[model samples]
Target: MLEQVANGKLTKWLAPSMRVGWSMVETVLLTAAAVGIGLWLRPEDPMTLDADFRWILLVPLVIAMRYGGLVGVWAMLCLIGCWYVLKTSGLYAQQSFPEGAMLGGLVFTLVAGEFSDLWRVRLMRADSAASYSLERLKNLTQRFVLLRLSHDRLEENLLTKPYTVRDALFRLRSLALEESSDTALPAGDDLLGILAEYCQLQRAALYPCRDGVIDDRPVAVLGENRPLEKDNSLLAYAMENQLLAHVQQEKEESYHGAYLVAAPISNSAGKIIGVLVVERMPFLSVNFENLQLLSVLLNFYADVVYAGKDTHLLLERWSALPFQMARELVALGRLREEGKVETSLTLFVADDSEQAGLILDALARGLRSLDLAWWVSDRTLLIMMPMTGVSGLEGYVLRTEQWLQDEFAFMSLRQAGVRFFYRHMDTRSTEVQLAELLEAGGV
Candidate 1:
């Protein structure tokens, strides 16, 4: 209650008032000084000498400057009137009132007038600086937000979807549609495929050979709807040196066509995952903003390859997750398949009806209810453990055995189907390797 009362008082004390609390304070102090000085300076003509009240004149000026501009003017006029009354009443022996009044007015005009001018300038400067800073902050925020959205879309295309020629072509075609003014020039085979389709490079097969020449071996070439030129040495050179090059630069002179460009793909860890390229003619017309967007999109492409952000969705559809989940059940019924991390997936087919309820009761010991990323395929549950390593797969499998023990005590958990397969992460080995390990242990 006391605090509330104090706040109310503070609200009433808003400054810049002519007859406010501070002005009253100045008035009292000045009046007292004038009275005291009059007696001290000339006691014989005390009223007459102080009648002008030269010192007291400053009180109203100070109040006006600090509070209201119009109040200061009114105060000067009042002081002059007071001096005349003192003189006319014969309280002052002064011959005329104008002399004292003039002195008081001069003092106010010089002191208070100068201060208000200086204060206005200072306030204006401060306001300008604040406005500039706010504008800059807003612009920066806008750029960051745009970049984030671009990254999201990039991950959706690169990491989540299966790499197919037709899929990639669709993306490139979409970009052309968006930038309607750009020429629909023929897209170079490799770069065009990824650009119009996947927002990546078409050069998946080009790699460095033993003799330092670029070789097209080990590339994932789409048959018939080829995305790369067969004998182009320049394309090979660019991919071999990890060089940034245009897909069109390698095109035959007779055709005189170039619409794609590609760079070697790198993962989040900066290791080359594969070559990433884009195909689009009239690309030179793209502005700085658009180019920045492309760079961001490509970086996310690398993330998909290395991070396995959406790999779970595909595996679930296959009814066989990429191995970190349900390791025990998947490990059964396979003799040749190694219970590995990256090379294979371990599936634990969970039953939805009777089997699910039974499994939940049996494995109710320590297994957490909040499983992060999981997939059900062929009635099997596949878990992607990004932290699991090959060595840890066995332990994860053991955990599975315990879960299975609740229902089929004699189901010899080791008799489940466990198969390991290697995913081609192109050149992004470390990230791919790490992903593989994570999927193995469901970490």
Candidate 2:
């Protein structure tokens, strides 16, 4: 608040009236000094130097260039006024060709002031255009840099094959769409199909595992329904090391003779969640390209699994999800205890349910990507913003209020019953409260 107050004072000092007043005062004082010097240097007879005071005219010219035409004109007028009073008081002798000498000084003042004003106007226009262009260039450069970085990240993560065809691009797009559309983790059938289509593997088996333990039979298989034996060392080695293992013909165990490749499906945290086994060909047939593609696809699959979604509606409204609220709070509490991140929650209440959707749409435009908004009730919205505190939440509320006013100038949204409340959740303390809310309904 103190800083803001100081800034306000600085702004007021820079206003036009303050600047012009100071400039005019300086001009007036200097012009009076020039007139006094002329009087001091005056001869007993002014006819000795008919235009002796002509040199003093430079003072007004200099002031005109420094403070602009208006100040310059006033300074010139004051100089002329002082000369008229001196001549009337009979302190300085009258000059011959007085009209011609005075006319020259008057013309000089008008010309200097006019040129000064012209230059000032031109300079202002040039500065404005330069500033506008520089701002546009800066914005474009930032957007371009962000676009390039996003493209580079996609390339590094996906590692598209060299000389990739249009078909490969289409396949990648299809996978992205499927990954976004499906709420749950990719099923075993989906993995098997990707292996066959992209990795050129015709035989494979998917074994489901939970927390690094394979507790169930094969969930999916291709080309054969035979389940992997429990004693298979190849499968055990892949799961134990959390890596892809290739069986050599000379070193292959008798029980695993038919299988050539075994890979583990790990989650984002590097936990072994499932195991994949394929035996369509020998180890030499599986190139590094195939392995890389497989790894990329599995990593994407792991992300979808970790996202914790069930249905499309739940995914769309994941912020205020009743089922996930307790889990999210638990994770937030752990992070806070570990001194990792900050979190804040904001609630927007609408007195009129009919305008809730409109308010939500406008609010979304003002929120960051990490911020999530969901409707907990018909007239209430809960927004969870990661890495934000109470002060940041206040700024967000003010920005949203301003945006609503700008977008809906015809209607007063704030006066129509939209209200917002925010609190910085002490994640450690709010965990139990969040759990209770989840058990009842979303907060």
Best by TM-score: 2
lDDT of each: 0.43, 0.60
Clashes in model 2: which pairs? none
Candidate 1: regions farther than 4 A off: 1-194, 197-237, 247-280, 284-443
Q: Give the per-residue lDDT digits (tens) of candidate 1, residues 316-402.
A: 544434333322112110111212112223344433455454453333333332222344433334333322446556676666676
Model 2 residue 218 CA deviation in Å:
1.4
Window of ten residues with lowest summed lDDT in model 2: 161-170
RMSD of each: 16.8, 15.1
Per-model TM values vs. the true structure: 0.28, 0.38
lDDT leader: 2
Q: Indicate the TM-score of model 1.
A: 0.28
